[model samples]
Target chain A: MDELTAELTDLYNEHYSQLLRMAVLLVDDRSAAEDIVQDAFVRVFDSRARLRDRDRALAFLRRSVLNKSRSLLRRRQVSRKYQHRLVQREPGPDESAHGVDRTVLAEAIARLPPRQREAIVLRYYADFSEAYTAKIMKVTPGAVKAYCSRGVTRLSSLLRERV
Target chain B: MTELDTAAPRENSDERLLREGLHTLVRDVEPSPTALSRVLAKRRGRSGSRLVLGLTGVAAAATAALLLVLVLVPDRSPRPVPVGIAPDSYVVRLADGTLASAALETGEVLREFGRVDAEVTALAKGDEHVYAAVAGEGVLRVGPDGTTRRVRGVGRRAEVSAMSAANGRLAVAGGNRVTLVSGNSTRRITLDTGLVVRDLALDRSGRLALVVRDRDGGAPTLRLVPAGRAGSDRIRLFEPACAPLRIAWSSTGLLVLRPRDCAARDAVRLTTIDPRTGGRIGGGVGIRFEGPIGGAGDVRVSTDSADRVLVSTATGKTWLVDGGGVELVAEHCVVGRNCTPVPAAM
Candidate 1:
């Protein structure tokens, strides 16, 4: 109806699935990944007025999804580290799924450090420009390059080792 | 500098692999219908998000309430029972076909994707990929994430009649031959029998079962053709009464929809015959359900490759049956009848 609503619809319709995919890869849980994407849309919708160029809304959404994903990952890592009791961890969606090429790749990416995983996921998976990846990741272009190189190398070895 | 200026920055073989793999990884996965509906309803109920954002105090209070609910309350919802479905189960169907994987308990579509150019006739679910056969085109290897790679070297005129996937590979019976497609390599096995191949089924060991019509105007025959060979060691199983009883290899064994009586259109029994030895197994499954399982348009049998045997009628009725008889999974769609069943794993 309104410009904001129209823009939200377009972005959600076009990019929400992709953004959801990005989050799913970052975090292996489907429910949590959807929540992360939902959080991203809420963030974007709340700050829509500040967005001077609506064309860049997708980029903003991507950035927000990455940010939200990173936060969730951080919380997961902390919870894993500080658990007082030896609780059995529940298997996530990706872990439960057997077979399929993407399932293997997702599991491997999940094992990488957050920055390296993000670098590979953005530069290669998302096909983002290095500069744009650097902006979303909040790192220097050189750092992005290093992360991508290391991530790719690690991924190659990780997948190869599995075989 | 040129790399920086260009659209692709540091594109390489590894990047290509990453891109391809990642694209396939998330292709068919969609956000949960529950989460999506929640967001949609919120937007519709409140005209503007601006109104909510402007009221920071209200937002804070709402956030506090949400936090309180999370802390003070414990989730009591019953965990959904496992419905013998693979975690990454997916299917490929025609655009008009209902192609959404749904929650077992709720029957709400969990994930759905794929809008192909050609009509999807056959779908094969492999361990690592889902292969779809489009008529007059070629077989497409689909990743769980929805990325599709049209198989090459199989030729375009292979109008797929039946398909099966197992052990990280797929086999499509198009026309009078069956082609085994894995990665980049394809091997074709022509029947040379002068009979049209009707249906196909493959077991975990790659044993193929075919239903073919006899050129001499005799009863249609079923053939057990092994992989990588054409006619060598091929065994003709028996005559299939129903044309659609071509071949469906379930976890139990190779399943055949055997009609109860030669003339009875509505009643048929499901039997597991050994693909290696054409002998019928111990006990057969016969449903006592009363409905229109007519000879109107031939019965269609689908499986989730785990623990499901869905028999559908031409008039839009579907029955979920086990080894013995019918199980009431859902008569109509959980959402509605207009909702499509996602191929095998509905």
Candidate 2:
């Protein structure tokens, strides 16, 4: 009913699913993906005073989601080192719920180094333009192109072998 | 591959497969309905919690009506002689972030305590020297002997954010990992919780405690990582709350400054805990202040007095707290040197 709530509702209704998918593709865990997206929205709401333009809300949310996902992945990696099997229960191999052969795709993307995986997710999975991906990743368009190329090359090799 | 863009190049088969495959993998996914509601509910809860705090500021008028009460001290036997730093020397951070220790009366820098090239971000002192985290660099030790050497095995490129030292043991934390160092044997410890490192503390026996914050805006946690030699038994401790920004250690116990209402952020409770088990040691003092301190300065444990603790803030506020009470011994001044009432135990 209020202005802030009304604006957030509209944004959430429009892009919540999109952002969730983006996080899922990057992090490869449904529960972690949902937390990452919610965390991003919380941050946007908390720092609403700093954003002057209404149009940039989506852009800001996207960038925050990417950065938070990167940090979460790094933290999880470090945690798994010491705690072993207790911290990370490996998901048994299963086919995609949508029948899209996502297990292989997920494994390949996870194998890519963090930055390349991030670039690939923003460019292809989220369907952002090169310039927009650069803005979200805080790199130049050329850098985005480079990461995507390297990531795509590696992913293609891995997926091809699965056939 | 689903949702294949028709505008793709006629060549480059790898790009096509990757993009099309990604679209198919996520095309059917949707956000949970409860997710948006949870977000809205959390913000509402945060807004409703911000109530203007009423503080019982420093008891000034009560000085005339001194209601002296006998203090009941704990019966723990006197432990081994605690290590680190001479009783009279004081350590502090200048306004520009340089670390220095001085005499109690004249504010003369006895010796600078870090490398100049890399700014000192975090500092902790031992008896002979001060162990400082040089921003993006690892740990550096500076002392009365004028010897400066980088602490090995703590990753030379590590941007260490927190350092805690007592006796001969040291623990340095940045991110989720903590490097426990004693002499030449250094061990890297990764906390089981996938949380960011907010603060770190170490007792004289090399017991480590870390304050880790969740990815969300929830209350932070204080987790004591159990450390002992091979085949030695250990006890684990974990306390979750919006912990204060600083944690100190003395011969008696580990000291934690717990704020009353984290949302209001006014009054603070000074508690001493058994380092091995997170158990409270004795009756503590309550301190009410107007605002938060600027940064973590230094913590000097009292060897002579009723085991009082001296803590300094970057904004030049020094406090002395014991079983009796918490007193503002200095304002706009570091401990030992130039502090009002001249901190007697420093």
Clashes by residue pair, model 1: A100-B128, B25-B145, B26-B145, B27-B145, B27-B146, B28-B145, B28-B146, B98-B340
TM-score of chain B taken alone, candidate 1: 0.62
lDDT of 2 by residue, B1-346 (tens): 1222344654376666677778766666788869889988876776555322112223533543354333444557878343344443456555555456653323345555543455666666665667777766678876644467788888777867677776677788887778888889888877545566766777666676666666555556566665663221222334554455556654456667666566655556666667667656644566666685332232222321124466555445556553233445456555344422111223
Question: What TM-score would you give candidate 1 relative to the actual structure?
Answer: 0.45
Lowest summed-lDDT stretch of 10 residues in model 2 chain B? B297-306
lDDT of 2 at A82: 17
Which residue pairs clash within candidate 2? B84-B127, B85-B126, B85-B127
TM-score of each: 0.45, 0.43
What is the C-alpha lDDT profile of model 1 across A56-134, one tens digit per residue? Answer: 6666778888877767765654344412110123334544222324545666777676677788888766777778887
Off by over 4 Å in 2: A1-163, B1-85, B95-98, B103-117, B229-244, B275-278, B293-306, B333-346
Candidate 1 overall lDDT versus native: 0.61
| lDDT tens digits, residue span B177-244, model 1 | 78876667877777766776766766667777777765555545677777665673444445444433
